[model samples]
Target: MHGPLNPESPVAAKVFPSPNHGERKEGRRPDMVILHYTGMASESEALQWLCNPVSQVSAHYFVFEDGRVLQLVPEARRAWHAGRSWWNGEDDTNSASIGIEIANAGHPGGLPPFPDAQIESVIALTKDIATRWRVPAERVLAHSDVAPGRKVDPGEKFPWEVLHEAGVGHWVKPASIQDGRFFSRGDRGMPVEALQAMFAMYGYGIKISGVFDEDTEKVVAAFQRHFRPERIDGVADASTIITLRDLIAKRPAPTAS
Candidate 1:
């Protein structure tokens, strides 16, 4: 059971108490959800590490490869999973988000595809959390999204489209990949600045410096990984640009607007 063994999700069978959590920073209520992959060969090891105090990491939920769901931290408490992360202007994302780590042999294990059963579990769990927390469909994000330079978990093969089809998170038909105008590191100008602004407006921690620096490249790659998984070469190509524009266009309108 989680330290308090409180079950936050109706779909989760039980709490698996992880010691690696603390008070939500400044009494923050989660407004976002961050998904991650354990990146371990086995769920047992990953679970053990997450609860191990030395690991200093935990998530609100953990989904096994076989589809079993477990809560590792109380939903009302801050889980330590998102470390040194940012989204929009919020730096301590852990406090403002619920983290879920899916068990998988990650990119180091050759980027193994997430099992269909596991993905199903993720969709259900995410739907429950997002509904309960009133998290925006677009605010359901990848770990790499909040920590662009440091993380790539729940990588490109995580089947975001499948989740989208399940009515869990935001997604779109990725634009067709083709040769076209593109921006890569070292490119510069108003167009590049505009690209950075778009990414930043969409919550990626990119700077509108006008120079296509490494940070911008990583953020672009992160965007590609989550939004347009067809290609992730750190270049802002036409397909990527078009895809970003589409997502922005489709975002929900404000109540007054």
Candidate 2:
């Protein structure tokens, strides 16, 4: 509820402070950046919803379709976004990350394209935040990445590769989709356990129970949505697994504290 705030990053045009944030728990410093899409048809309404106290949701920044950037919450504070989300064993993502909500129609509006100007602005803003916070490349994540089944904003149509090309986030060429051995729901075995283990090792919240259950499927789909976005059927095909291995191999070294 702070009156007219100053923008923290040079990329933001102005401050549009929201009342929906709090101090980061345990005095946590952000090491991650979570991207989301405001899935409403009207950008103004979406922004208002985030600022409304009744909604209990807000992000650190808001990016409009024309690429205008607005700082809704201060970077040091914890925005109310990323509810019930987890990443790399951290359940309180709101405290551990900065959230950016991009204005887009998302799946509900047939997945509209993000304008080039918008994408460029997102790149600049993300790079600024990541640089200031020393956020790892892989830690620049989608809302769906951390909350899988519960959310899917900033959908596949969002150009992650574009951001990666600008040195903002992680990206590798996805493997070609082809027919091969695949694992699906209800499958069980050591291979399934191994698959789950790999996902968990890569920071997905999956259980290695030697069975491909519903949760595993959701995680797989989430992985596909972020990594191998060419197809997101929740089936772990050869392309999906190989792409994951490539990503793991190319993941940047952990940043020193």
Best candidate according to TM-score: 2
User: After aligning candidate 2 to the native by TM-score, how far in Å is the CA of 15 from where it should be?
Assistant: 0.7
Give a tens-digit lDDT track for model 1, residues 228-257.
988889999999999999988887764331
Model 1, poorest ten-residue lDDT window? 248-257
Candidate 2, 63-130: lDDT as tens digits: 99999999999999999999998889999999999999999999999999999999999999999999
Model-by-model lDDT, in order? 0.89, 0.94
Q: For each candidate, give its TM-score against the true structure.
A: 0.96, 0.98
Write out the backbone clash pairs for model 2. none
